[model samples]
Target: MKRIALLMVLALSLYSCDTDDDGPNLNFTIAEITGTDLPEYFEIGESYDLEVTYELPNACHQFSNFSVNPYVDEETDSTFVIEIAALISYDANITDCTEEGELTDSRTIRDLRVSSEDYNNYQFKLLTGEDENGEAEFLIIDVPVGEPEPETPEENTNA
Candidate 1:
């Protein structure tokens, strides 16, 4: 019983010491259309909530609050687009998205469009203190969400 108690205390201490600043951070937001399961289109001068995620290497400090801007690009008209931008740490800017870092800071971005062949694709990138190649960054998998078509009587026969 005494040994178990000691182990529990040690575990708690390690878990409590986890924090954010001790490593790199990550954050991003995705928006989908309001109805009919479509890609969320961005209009001129519109407001949208950007979901953000913050990752830390050391797990000693808490993640920071989100700072995302919902901006649109007028240069492209064939489809609606949304621009996601945020500042991440250098540690989070390693060759692999999961590299451990004690300190970091950089700009992360995602460019999406409503009417493109790859409309559901995300352009993930990380820009750190300088401009150079071999920079730390990783791209997330493409995710698509659409309404399921109603099954007809013939399709339901399997059930």
Candidate 2:
């Protein structure tokens, strides 16, 4: 019983040790996709690079990554929700963080092969902001997609 009590004390002592606090406090937010440079049309079974532009809220907010989420509203939708995922580091000394400007950030969605065979277009919903009812408002863009080119057969008559 004494050995058990000693082990409990050791575990408590180890848990009370101080941890290093060298990193800043981080918070995350989903920024709006203000601009996009996409092709006029997309071909099925083809891959393309998409460029999105957005601005950070302030100096403390750093561009971390792009959040590309897919949504399906119906049977024919190949919808995607695109936004900028930012890391907001809270520092008491930084005060000039509210200036919003056009800062172009580049990200590539490589090899985007839509699996739906019947989708006629690609829908992108950009989260513009929240409404007065606290619901998300989106800037919807629908880009038409062309049918995939038919594959040609080889000119060999081998059975």
Candidate 3:
């Protein structure tokens, strides 16, 4: 009788050990940033629009929010380096999603003013994920000072 009781307990425990594997597998791809209306050269004290794009493994992965951190370094009096880091998050939801998904967003950079006396160029580094495991992309842009408007020739009023 004791042997039968032990066998029954073992069987019940084994049956209770079954776990559900219906949770969604969430993963993300590298995020990217691109200039939308920016020209080859950026004028001092001007605003420009930028576009940010990212993707998820599947539709089951929902976007929560994202944040970007910018770092600036002065390589020289005429050159500067800027690094932008992105932190993307997603919701852990279990759903039936088979198709891959993408997310696109926009941001504006206002008044790109430089205080350097001889500013000429800028190098941008865009990155995503943590410092330990992340990817970095680069973009180089030239900075040209706006041309001064020419003064119209005054008509000879004494003619």
Candidate 4:
């Protein structure tokens, strides 16, 4: 009877250990846009680099791939709007689940260009997943053709 009981316990242990493991849950969070040296207003025909600072759930999470999708809307001769969709992927390997501490990653925007046009504003949608249903954030900014000129006062004429 003791031998049968021991065999049953061993079988249960083996069965429990055989259960499938999906993987570690890795995620990304955008901390901030660190730099791109972008001016307050963008100039036409000028190229700019966009840098972003992001945070990972832990050190085990590593970036795998990223992409940006732009949709041009309200097209005109000199002005238009572009809605940007950004996606980031992470290495979800379960084998290397290490220290549980926050990790930061920096990345630059690639293959994105701004052309001279009538568009003065842009919107960005940062997606956290491949599907359209995951977490998302929006960022909007204005693009100006040239540097803004300082206003001049005509006080001398009144005096």
TM-scores of all models?
Answer: 0.26, 0.63, 0.45, 0.52
Better of 1 and 4 by lDDT: 4
> Model 4, residue 76: what's the lDDT?
46
State how far residue 74 of model 2 sits from its true place (Å): 2.3
- Candidate 4 local lDDT, 80-138, one digit each (tens): 44433323445555656666765666676754566746566544444432336653444
Worst 10 residues of 3 by lDDT: 66-75
Q: So what's the TM-score on candidate 1?
A: 0.26
What residue pairs clash in candidate 4, if any at all? 78-117, 78-118, 79-118, 79-119, 80-119
Which residue segments of model 1 deviate by more than 4 Å? 1-52, 78-81, 85-159
Superposed Cα deviation of residue 42, candidate 3 (Å): 1.8
User: Which residue runs of candidate 3 sit more than 4 Å off their true CA positions?
Assistant: 1-37, 60-74, 93-118, 128-159
lDDT scores for all predictions?
Answer: 0.36, 0.63, 0.52, 0.54
Q: Could you say which candidate leads in TM-score?
A: 2
Q: Write the per-residue lDDT of candidate 3 for residues 29-89, one digit (tens) a residue.
A: 4444443344556666665555444444444444444344434454455566655433344
Q: Give the local distance difference test score of model 1.
A: 0.36
Counting only residues 3 or more apart in sequence or on different chains, how many pairs clash (N, Cα, C under 3 Å) in candidate 3?
Answer: 0
Q: Model 1, range 1-159, lDDT digits (tens) per residue?
A: 999999999999999887746454444322111111123333333333333333334333333433333333345333223333333233344445543444333222233333334232322222122226744343222223233346665655555
lDDT of 2: 0.63
Q: Candidate 2 or 4, higher lDDT?
A: 2
Tens-place lDDT per residue, model 2, 1-159, is 999999999999998895966555566676655767777777777777776666555545666766667656555455443333322234554556664654545455566665555666777776666789988777777776774567798888885
